[model samples]
Target chain A: MTTWDGAAAAERVAIISDQDVVRVRQLVRTLAVAVKLSLVDQTKIVTAASELARNTLVYGGGGNAEVSRVDNGRKPGIRIVFADEGPGIPDLDLALTDGYTTGGGMGLGLSGARRLVDEFEIDTEVGKGTTISVTKWCR
Target chain B: MERVPVLKIGDILLVSIQIDMEDQVALQLQEDLADKIVVTGCHGVIIDISALDIVDSFVGRTLATIASVSKVLDADTVVVGMRPAVAITLVELGLSLPGIRTALNVELGMKLLAQEREQYELDLEDEDEEPAVSTR
Candidate 1:
């Protein structure tokens, strides 16, 4: 259980299993509607959530996520934070590259998920863990 | 292990992915689809993903694989009801789903399959006649 600023997140969930991927997608849908994101934005962010959730389970070896309604003084947005304490990534550049995978995926999870969001952030340690946070603003 | 139901309509297989699939379930659905296509001798497969709001890489690859697998089995696959957002995300994700056909809805998907089938039969007939002429 990683500690996060719950003040930012209106809801949170765990991502410890394969099925949790689906649950996280569902949770994203809920937040998407709550934030009244357009249908396209909703799908994009939800799809992003699906990718990150799978990464949390498969690569990060299970983690947790938080969804929050955020404002940057310009527009309202929904922020997603995925944190995990699994075997931390040793190489951030390789991990972010398209078609790069330690796991047997197409290597689109990280790069692809990045394209679908408005803002993306990544923090990782060699032995500790990784934390990824993203935002999708309502247009 | 949740299995997506495969419904047979005439000689066509209808697979609607209504729920977000686990990895196991997605793989299972792929296997089951292959079996169903063979068992039913389906000439066409229409996969409806309208209910799928979010298509991650896994799901996207599963769909692409399903399309190619059905083609190898001599069946046409038409993915239907792809939301605009899903399509945009797939392209950005570098999943073009090449060689896989898509339509706006099931009705249009069925139409595409029918057109493909007709063209295939026409090509077959043309080949048959060409062999006769060459042999003569």
Candidate 2:
């Protein structure tokens, strides 16, 4: 279910387990390279995608990641959205804290991923799981 | 279980993470490394991660655990050949990898490990030859 139109080159993959995290990183890297993002930006975006994919697996159970190359006005960028249908975050503020984790993680995925990207947004419900979207623009 | 082969170079054990690291593969590497360290009695371990483009939190934790375990077995560990981009990403990921030694390339890493082993030998010799004497 994408409303991205034809302008954006997009792909989706399941984030079900640890192997899926590797796949998500590869997909994000492919899109970032295709858009000619600098090596630093590519690494940042790929790492961010990895953290989110793991979160979708470990925290949110199983989910999927949507990666797209987009144009934000004249600037070209890559956007990744991760969606999960498992138990949702109970408190957004606490989850975004730098050293808070519920599942034995280093507790840096949310805040660290946010720092790596140009934009970040998250939506969650008590019982409806979560959606976290991030974008990294070429610099 | 997916196993990562550990190559023996003199007294140094070298493991290059060249493939996509599945969680099982990482665990296997840890188990195999413990056994190899005991059997080979290698004094140093060098992990080459240059081929790995990204190291997430879990992988980072695994590497740290490997280093710690090797340390307990009297083997020093050095991680070498991290890409510049991966370094930056690691910083952003907030994993400092404290107490883990890292070098730029395999050659440099080998040199560092040699120096470390030399120092360890010197320390042992001093322990055997010299006794702590209290001078009142």
Which candidate leads the pack in lDDT? 2
Q: Give the Å error, residue A65, model 1.
A: 1.0
lDDT for model 2 comes to: 0.88
Ten contiguous residues minimizing lDDT sum, candidate 2 chain B: B127-136
Q: What would the per-residue lDDT of candidate 2 be over residues A82-101, giving only the tens digit for each residue?
A: 99998899999999999899
- Which portions of model 2 show Cα errors greater than 4 Å? A1-6, B127-136
Error of 2 at A79 (Å): 0.7
- Give Cα distance to truth, residue A23, candidate 1, Å: 1.5
Q: Could you give the CAPRI-style class of model 1?
A: medium
lDDT of 2 at A53: 92
Cα RMSD, each candidate? 4.4, 4.5
lDDT of 2 at B24: 73
Each model's lDDT: 0.86, 0.88
